[model samples]
Target chain A: MIFPALRVLVPVALVIALVAIGLRIGDALGIGPDPAFTLLAGALFGVLLQRSRFCFYCILRELFEDRDSRASYGLLVALAVGSLGYVAMFGSWVADPGAGRLPPDAHIGPVSWVLVVAGLAFGIGMTLSGSCISAHLYRLGEGSVLSPFALVGALAGFVLGFASWDHLYVETISRAPTEWLPARFGYGGAVLLQLAVLGALALLLMRRLPARPARDAAAWRLRAVLDAVFVRRWPAWVGGAGVGMLGFIAYFRTSPLGVTAELGSRARTLAERLDLIPGRLAGLDGFSGCATVVIDALMTENGVFILALVAGSLAAAIGAGAFRPRRQPLHRYPLALLGGVLMGWGAMVALGCTVGVLLSGISAFALSGWVFGAAVVAGVWVSLAVRNRVRMRLSARHPAG
Target chain B: MSTLSKSLRRTAALLLALPLLAAGQAVADGPVVSTSWLAERLGDERIRVVEVSVEPGRFERGHIPGAVNFRWHTDLVDPVRRDIASPEAFSKLVSEAGIDADTTVVLYGDHNNWFAAWGAWIFDLYGHDNVVLLDGGRDKWQRENREMSRRPARHAATDYQLDVAKPELRARLADVLEVVEGEHRAALLDIRSPAEFEGRIFAPPGIQELAIRAGHIPGAKNVPWDRVVRDDGTFRDTEELRRLYADIGIDGSDPVIVYCRIGERSAHSWFVLSRILGYEARQYDGSWTEWGNAVGVPIDNPAGTVWGGT
Candidate 1:
């Protein structure tokens, strides 16, 4: 009620943002990157995210508390479908094992354990913060109070991350390999490994479809394999495919789909200009390199891509007739701020978010995604425990406030 | 409802609604030309291409057949700061480049079309209705087919008409700063990376002060410029573009001021926001490069950022 229009408009707005991202990437590459294509895709995502109520937190919660994996199943299916598309288009990796350029920031380079710890931190932190990196990206579009804090915190965490780099690099990172996916399983093997692993997960979800009726309608997303196959109908799949296709096409334009590097560079630029920080943040620059930041500085590249994603999502929201923004209880603001800071910190420490580090990394056949995802989930759980105790204390005190 | 249900409901509902009218001209039908289209128009005396690349002399070293090098850092931008050239001076520069109201101009350069876009912004500002940025730029052209490079450019000067076309299209430094301060509620857009917005330190000295105390202009939003571009330096579609704007808090009436250090990068975003997606987007030509380093402007950077907004 506080921000009425925003509440009703948020989801759609977020979808539009993503679609615009696609279109912008399209333009950056000059590959007929039509805003229309991204627009429609955004609409589709809006519809899906809205209809399915897809939140990784909810999925994890169900899995953790109710022993339900329905939401998790849906997510896996989406990833499987999308990852297949990514590999099919780009192939495993460029030729010349030693020479070819891999996807930007996809692999966790020489920071294996640190990355794993970061991922776990993110996973758990997302739960505690009440949203994952990708979810927050869109949720902010929807006017979530906690979203801003999370974002701010992320920024703070990144700034602070500079302080720890020397240690992270010397003790934890220097000894590790950057491209674990390649080291463990050559390019071809890694691509195949993804298919095998995710393919298996997809099959497991398929088998669970029959038991859906036993669970509450809200709890069960689909009827396992059959519904997973047919329930979402063509639109959801199309929308998901569109995002995946956009991801594929993104490879042709600038770098593969990434959000963190851009965010990081933007953050760095602000710190320097505003004097919010010292002129330099120490080891971060050398670790990341100038080309990466320069690409993020591109006005028409990542900037437009993010724009398209949001705009496209908004359009999708409009088409499906579900575009509306809703304000959550204001009491959540402090928690939101705290949560945001943690997630932001985690994202910074880890070098990316779910979409940035995890998804992008996975697509590149990088092992860092695995590390970040797992660690973030762990962090989320830890945060959630803290929240539970706080909630209990609040309930004991005022019962409602 | 619990947070989960609330989130799910919001997501579902968002997937189900209708949006407002297309963000005014936020839906840009800006012309995108292929290398082929450029080649066809190359030799025509009426056409001029502007090479806007980042490298020191990328434009001077080689360019499209009949193109002129527009040094984003030097010519199109104010030497004092990232602010755009004054209108009178801007038009004269256009003419000096052999471009006119009727000149069929094509823009392209290295690093996708990032630099090239700054040139396009120049055209838009001066009301040169006949300019089009080469889609996919030379990088893509080189990939799909053979590429052409003009011999190093030769100096040519002509008396150009300092035509007053549309001064309103630009966002003055004051205007940008005002919006950033949340005075006019102008949607301050950082076309740079999140790091840049967060003051992660790496800003060139010229634009350091414009950064907010904490990070970002308290109310400013970020939409990295790369989001608008592709790997091969091409752009995405319109529908997608609209979505991108929505995601980044860009509303048609939001009064957006897009900026990057010297405004060259911001110009690229300016094109995307104003030209493609058709939002009332203006480029803060002075960007951080000027405002950040301005003598007495309010500067905010708390030692907590990478660039430090110093």
Candidate 2:
């Protein structure tokens, strides 16, 4: 038992030590302190997300299919905690919320029909691909074969999005209203409104949640401690709270908690180099949701953060002995590729993914966040319904099997 | 080897070196200085390097050694009003930044020296003849892996005075209006994006400062400011720039009025025309913000885009 625990503990300890040394000497390597801090924050977020199974698609699918709203509750708790944290930060930053001055680098974005379309596409993509973008990133560490295809498909989708960006920007996105809740309702009022909405959603979800199971008392021993550390999954609320705290600290110390900026930037750069996209992405730079730029620097905050996230997830997955690589059917690959394309296009048009736009946007009290979330839920429900019907029809035809 | 012969030889040597010295001074007095030129004279007493980036905190992160930061929002512009800094304020800023009448101020910044060009305009307005822009600015320097420092530059304050504000270099709303009404005989150069000039969008997609009306001043030629700079953020060669401007019929014959969404971008064009090409050009700093928003002003919106209209 001690030997197994040591195997798990050593790798995790080594990862932490390496991260510490990197942070200490980051400036010398042209990685500024801000990006270094982002790396730390991203790693912690990756661990929390993986341990709690905090995939938005998984959470929503479980709620709809199994009537298990436990993970949904975690998402709600995260939103509630994050909103409160944001309001506190906003209050200190802007004495008067009505002053029309927005906090710098928040994920507040424009609300428009394009955003809704993006959200819906993202939802359907998540259902088909079996995970959201951030989830796929962590699951890559868990040795998921589909994640790579999905991510690559997403890159291709970004190029497509860039190709279509001008038309969309000219038509509707240019005129879209960027609605910040704090601008109308004060910071306190905005946070209260968010909490109320989250609370009401929590109550609605609570009705469908399965009852809690009975727990057995266990002796406090070394084996039990080791098992809890290396085997047991963290509770939903614990992960939610941890994520919320991290979101606040990330925003306060660096920029917002976003993951798609680096990916989008890379895709944009690749497209530009290949001449697959226009020279200038029309009006792309002005909006704030994980804005992508033509890459000039060797390291960006988001770039380092993403790399650290994958590393951290790998470390955590290894410690838990959950790094299992399995082969999948050939047919599933195309589905993942298709799904990734949809998600990539959706993320680009929407200006972010679940983590950047939905989580960080909601935390910033942007109306776009809530609107995108609702649209995503609708898309998922509709996709799931269609899939179920197809499966039922196929099963009925093969009743002999 | 007599004393009289030795003195005669020395005089001849000094005469021979005069032309070389003057040629060197001519290069130093030009509108733009190369990265190598500035790099060699980083700590020279006569030179003062100023960084005026569009984005905040860029200077504090890492900047050229011995460069002082001048935030575009607070340091360059008027704190409250939508205008350039006043003469008195400019004087204080220059004096505090340790710039004197004779100091060769080398301005550089991010976004291809967009705000740094504006700084040069400001310095020019105050009759600082020795001011020049760092060619390619911060982008090129960083790309070349030039030395940078996080330490704030410290220089003893000088008693800099604003003696002559060059009104000829700045175009006001009335001047632009005259051009729009066909009363003025200057070339109206719109340096904003084509989408902006055509009224497809009010401003750049995410830009907060906007004009209610969308379009260019009637008859303004659309040559985006970015065309003047190479991919590396440096200005194009003189012959190429001449040919590019000549295609639009903006020869040195007629005075040119350059304008953009705001004044900063136009200042870049203003630098190219006035300083680089030596054209009789003026920067309409009020630009589209003043022209597009002003009621009863004539606008030629090619796209016919209306606010909140399908």
List residue ranges in candidate 1 displaced over 4 A: A1-52, A89-93, A96-109, A141-143, A180-184, A199-210, A213-243, A281-300, A317-327, A389-401, B1-310
Q: By summed lDDT, which 10 consecutive residues of candidate 1 chain B come out lowest?
A: B19-28
Alpha-carbon shift of residue A3 in model 1 (angstroms): 16
User: Candidate 1 on A1-401: residue-level lDDT in tens?
Assistant: 33545544654565555555555554344222343453443344434454454556766676665656556665555555556655554343333334444433333444577777667666655665677655665554444557666666666666555556557766766667666465456557766787788768766655434363454455354445434332332333443444455554544333455545545557666665666655533335434211123223345344444544445444433433334466667766665666655655556666667766665556656666666666666765666677678779989999775
- Tell me the spans in candidate 2 whose CA falls farther than 4 Å from its real position: A1-10, A13-17, A28-33, A219-222, B1-53, B56-310
- Model 1 lDDT on a 0 to 1 scale: 0.59
What is candidate 2's CAPRI-style docking category based on DockQ? incorrect
Each prediction's whole-model lDDT (CA): 0.59, 0.84
For candidate 2, lDDT tens digit of each residue in A1-401?
22567557755785877578566745544343365687788778778877787889999999999989898888888888888887777765555768776666688888899999999999999988888899998888777899998998888888888999999999989999988998998877787788889989988988887878776467368887777665677777888988888888777676778788888989999999999997688788977778988886787778878877777777777777777788898878998898999999999999999888898899999998898888889888989999999889989999874
Q: Which residue pairs in candidate 2 collide?
A: A286-B206
For each candidate, what TM-score against the reference?
A: 0.49, 0.64
RMSD of each candidate relative to the true structure:
21.2, 12.3
DockQ, prediction 1: 0.02
